[model samples]
Target: MVSKLKMVLIFISIPVISLFAQDKPELHVGGALRFNYNLSSWKEGQKTRGGDFGYDLFRINAKAKYKGVKLNAEYRLYSQGFGGGMLKQGWVGYDFTPENNLQIGLTQVPFGITQYNSHNWFFSINYYLGLEDDHDMGLKYTHNSENWLYAFAFFKNAEELNFGNNSDVSNSRYSYDVSSSGDGLYRNKEINQLNLKVVRKFSNGGANHMLGVSAQYGGIYNLDTENTGDHLALAGHYELDFGKLNVKAQVSKYNYNTKNPAGQSNDMIAMTAYGAPYLVASEGTTYTLGVAYSVPVEWGPISNLQFYDDFGFMDKKLNDFHDSYMNVTGVLITAGNVYTYVDAAQGKDQPWLGPVWGGALSEGTANADWEMRFNINIGYYF
Candidate 1:
């Protein structure tokens, strides 16, 4: 007896396989296995350092393209406490022209920098706020030319197939998790969200520069509380590239507002997918600066060596809350299909700061006036 879930998977695969069999679509299969080793220390409490080692993640991605139609999907398994097996992205798209396309399914939202240029496996702070690796069931239209890129998308839900929270009251304090209790900052499960981004590029003095603007609006209604809350963000980013050197920076201001039947404000604390959520006075500004320098080296099997620094800062609107910031410095070594990242990071008033590859430090209770973590990640792709 096949389970219903398995049956659904089989049904979804039929058309994909048929396309390859009949239309002879181009197919590609690839995957990566990642591992991590970490050591961490805190400023106030434990005088001794703590460490851990484990498999970070295993991921497989497949894509097929025939004429103007394409399909892309990825399956991921996480070993850390993050979660279990899940679909990272699965989308089908149609290309009307080389520069224009329409995508429908579970895909990334077009907001802020699409890719972080950090050498560390862990991305900057924006990632936690649904700016990186954030995907949803939606429809997106994209247009790209030699000098301009534009994207607009609408998502029915911020996340799909989440079973972590079943209770009416959201006990979890994260944004990515479904919250029924209203404890979750982004508790609205049925989110009607819209996102937009536009960028323009130019070249000067052997370098390329890009400037862009991004915006997002999302809302969810809590049936239990008969209230509604919404998330809003507006941001701008700039990127500069000179041969082997690259610099990227972005600034964003966001607000989460809620209203009840009594006309009273019930704005919850701001939270991310992971780490400790903080109280916001309704709005805050986040900034990220990342710089990378690639060095051409022919040492052993090493093809490239890149050193980088990624910094993130958050300024809360509330006067009672202290500012938060994180700084990560790392080196990336690439040898053929294998890549390694060695990183050192520290932060204050930021419990979410850690390795991108998982396994570093646990959430601390006290404000991290100064906490440090060292991490190393190795991955191989085939």
Candidate 2:
């Protein structure tokens, strides 16, 4: 099947190349190699057994621009002790303007702070940002202006990353032993997603501020279990400069749903919503606040030299409104700082490496007493 797909892509690329070859344009290709090391404390039986040194990302990206059309492809390879492999996202985009385009193919839905933010790469924020997954097969349209921007995407089911009620016994191979947002998170034969986002900027002379709104609806049609949910999110970001001090704040909320019927899992039977008609799977909201003080290296050849630190927190409230017995709450906090480098010639690339520490606390008979992680990550784009 993989060979067949590759053949189809090759056939499609031939005609596309022929059409673009007439324009005589420039082709640019590049990628990055990144590594991460975790000095985390762990307990036996925990799913995330820490691998000391992990090749976080090794990717190659190719893009060709001709006339008003652009074609891009990215392939990534990752490895840890368990094993790793490769995946690719190949898409074609046509620009209506220099800053506006309609792109179709596999892509990332730009919905939340962490969705498009690259600064937090070295430190995985699965526990904090609720944006742990990667790109999916989809069609996306994007528009950007000076002070306002928006995007919308339609997607197919990408189930490898779902958790919480969405991963029930019938739909997922794994047992529904643990509970979280995707508890019964399973996709039937039919799965699709629609995501939309809009953002407006504000300023008071010092620096700009942003207000963002996002929404996503995913459909799952399976007879055994219906795994459908919607996500609504709102956020704000502000940047202020006062002589030698800089401050910023950001926050977001994510609400999703899933299901677990009676006698499915031992844990499922104990939940209040088991016998109820509608089950309230799981939901959570998270936020981030940060501040930094920096001074330029006056005589040095450095660009914008600065020192910074940020604090982040996330809280999850999980319960079936119909089933209170299966209820729990989870909280997390993290603090980190890094040396940020800036270079205009590098385009959107920013290199940051830092030490980050965080801890997880939960109540209501969910899983463990507590889970914590400490890691150092270095990331850059070329």
- Candidates' lDDT values, in order? 0.70, 0.45
Tens-digit lDDT string for candidate 1 (173-251): 2224323323433334547889999999899899998899999898756544656678788989989999999998999
Clashing pairs in model 1? Answer: 122-356, 168-180, 168-181, 169-181, 170-181
**How many backbone clashes does every candidate have?**
5, 16
What TM-score do all the candidates reach, one by one? 0.81, 0.60
TM-score of 1: 0.81
Top of the candidates by lDDT = 1
Tens-place lDDT digits, model 2, residues 174-215: 111112223332223224777777877667766656667666
Give the best candidate by TM-score: 1
The C-alpha stretches of model 2 lying farther than 4 A from their native spots are: 1-22, 43-54, 80-83, 114-118, 122-134, 159-190, 221-223, 226-248, 259-261, 264-281, 292-306, 319-374, 379-381
Question: For each candidate, C-alpha RMSD in Å?
Answer: 10.2, 13.4
Worst 10 residues of 2 by lDDT: 344-353
